[model samples]
Target: MAAAKEGRKAPSRKSAAEEQLPGIEDARTAFAPALSGALERPRSMLRALRFRPPQLLHLEGGEAADRVALALWWAALLNCDDPEVMEPRASAMGPCLSCSSCLRLGVNMHPDLILLDGREGSIKIDDVRGLRSILGEKPHFSRWRVIIAAEAQALGIEAANSLLKVLEDPCPDTCFVFTAPQRERLLPTLVSRGWVVTLPWPEAGRPLAEELRPWEQALGRFVSEGRGWLDMTAARNGMDAAKAHQILLIGQKALADCLAGREGGMLAAVFRRMPAQALMQVDELFVECQDQLQAQVSPLLVLDSMAARLHILARR
Candidate 1:
């Protein structure tokens, strides 16, 4: 029963595509090549593949940057017989992928690694403090500790400042890798501290899938689903306002209808097509949407949050 309820809330592909058109497809194409390359490359040496690391790696266009990040992490771990001492356990895992490989690596048991998650709400000060405490402790398994903040943008002012202190003067062997859909979500101080790697959009005029007019078919499906399940709240869940507003109202209705017609558990299957980490973020956005609706915040802000969430959910 719980699984069923959870399944219903999941988003569908058709609905996801309907939420937006050319814009969403544009993001899809942006990282298509990179994604294809990574997925096809069998689990091997990702570092040897000319993989570039941008301090502020921007996964702007599609889910390409996200894929690249995941691949890099996996490859590094696989190759590093002793990543436990290098990358902390906290930095190793993420919101989506449940690949417990790290557990076998003794990473889950490592005290040096700190997993900072803010996908539920703003990453609390307590969470930050805990990480600091872990960092303060001498290295248990590895010389360098790692911190992977999945939703770095969720850091409140205090939390961000606290993290900034460590990022600026990180321990001699400490490395921090933060991920967010948009750079604007982070403070300038944080952004400036690291190298910036922006994910590129797919080459213009890329070939379209054979199903329908690539843009039109996808747009129609996404918008229809989004509108049907459209909740007018949750506008502030995203980085931008106006853009998010447009997405929520457009996508809500479409999403609901797709679910209604499914025989059973279809939505989950569609979502499985998306990246795992991305799926977690999308779920967070949906939760925020509901919160905004109940809080009766700016209807526009709520809607925008929904839109941005859907946009991320839809991107490959």
Candidate 2:
């Protein structure tokens, strides 16, 4: 996040979610009802509302775009105050896109909307302390103070302990949202406290979230097609280290699903065509890639190793 300053004007460089992103509309649609509930009967709902309309939300799974879009959208809806209504309204109408709050939030320039990117290393106690200090203040204009945290799993032990205090007695006007690749990444106590809403996979991959990116989809196709000679050069070249990591994860899941009698289902052809022993060896290599990624090894080298091994396996 930009430096912790009072009444800070949002930075010119915006997060991807600030711009109108791919899955943002879907996010608005998905969470419209909750926003509407907040607005429709604020008095009634507040007295009766349980955790369903979550004060603290754990947005798990989905692409970076999907998570960001949803988080920003939810924040905008909770804060929008435009009196205008759209034609042919949704059952749970969201923020009027034309409202000042909506416009500001669209660019993440809202004074009350805070976004915290927990560093990959760790989100220490000081970071949470700063956040608590900020939340201690009242919203400048919007009714709700919103904070969307990405990579929240990195919250260190002390930070997590401090945050638990806030969660136990949350501010009435404050809402918190967390987005992580996997739910297990967060501590169990934190996960248990928030309402976990698994956002749908990016439109590119539905149902099982399979076929997320070009390389991952191709990896799945190659495995299922079971063509021993399937060229992996395109998939290999298209990925950077991060993308390659995702591709390997998808490949690993495919192998596991196939082994568990999903042979004729998701990866039917690939499972049938590939030798069991060869697939197992490839799976082991992929696991090694995962360990290397966590250990901060060079991604290209990891991918190159996997590709070479797969090539040799195919040749055999």
Candidate 3:
């Protein structure tokens, strides 16, 4: 028997009888606004998935729980039985909250849904092997079998290689969803095989570590005073690729917060002074710096180049 139909009661007509899965509601609420704003691109991509679903879907960024909630919504929509829910009407923008499949997912009682929580521990080769038998079978009640691997960065090398092979040749009507803080954290081979979606950071904003405060302050000064404020010699001495990466990450977050009209101290205040277009350019610069660092560029060189570019933008 397929996992979907076994060890679960038949679908009930009264959706109210089911209780929501723990933490799902809060996760949903946290990401709700972003779905329409920061997450709109991913949401649009979901429409395409409805026609030809990808074998592997990788959602990078955002809180792990929030990503899971979005994945659940996708699963619910793919399997929803309500006829009226098929249209793209405003009223039908998301999963039909009252349908049997939606209800089943709400409470996490759906037989077709498999959740591999990496937070528990490392995902081993054994865990990947266990899913083979389940994937071979057809979905019992829904149109698609959804396997959500939350915090997929925890997957060990063997497990990632095992899962990568599965992604190369996926079973019919099955989708594997992986969530992590960033795609760079996952195996390059695995990342290459999936349809990757970049979600926004949560609206609440991620707090920067206290140790990063000096770097943050330096960023503010550089933005406000242009290249004159930067000390290339000191930066070269004090910065490594890892530290540079963290600084860029912090800058990206502050820029995002500024765009969202959130008050985020000095960094945000500096970002706010720039026009939206300039801020976007800064965001792109940060991404470029990250890519350059990944490609083994000298951290000091990248920082100097970034400072030069920001100086021009600050003048504009």
List residue ranges in candidate 1 displaced over 4 A.
1-79, 82-110, 200-301, 304-316
For candidate 1, what is the lDDT?
Answer: 0.43
- TM-score of model number 3: 0.56
Q: What is the RMSD of candidate 1?
A: 17.9
Across 40-85, the per-residue lDDT of candidate 2 in tens digits comes to: 3432322222212466778776665556666776676566554321
lDDT of 2 at 50: 21
Please give the range of 10 consecutive residues that has the lowest summed lDDT in model 2.
1-10
Higher-TM-score candidate of 1 and 2: 2
TM-score of each: 0.44, 0.54, 0.56
lDDT for model 2, on a 0 to 1 scale?
0.58
Q: Name the candidate, 1 or 3, with the larger TM-score value.
A: 3
lDDT of 1 by residue, 129-172 (tens): 87755655544443335466755655667778887776655354
Q: Please give the lDDT score for candidate 3.
A: 0.70
Clash pairs, candidate 3, are 4-111
* Arranged by TM-score, best first: 3, 2, 1
Q: Which candidate is the best by TM-score?
A: 3
Measured by TM-score, how close is model 2 to the native structure? 0.54
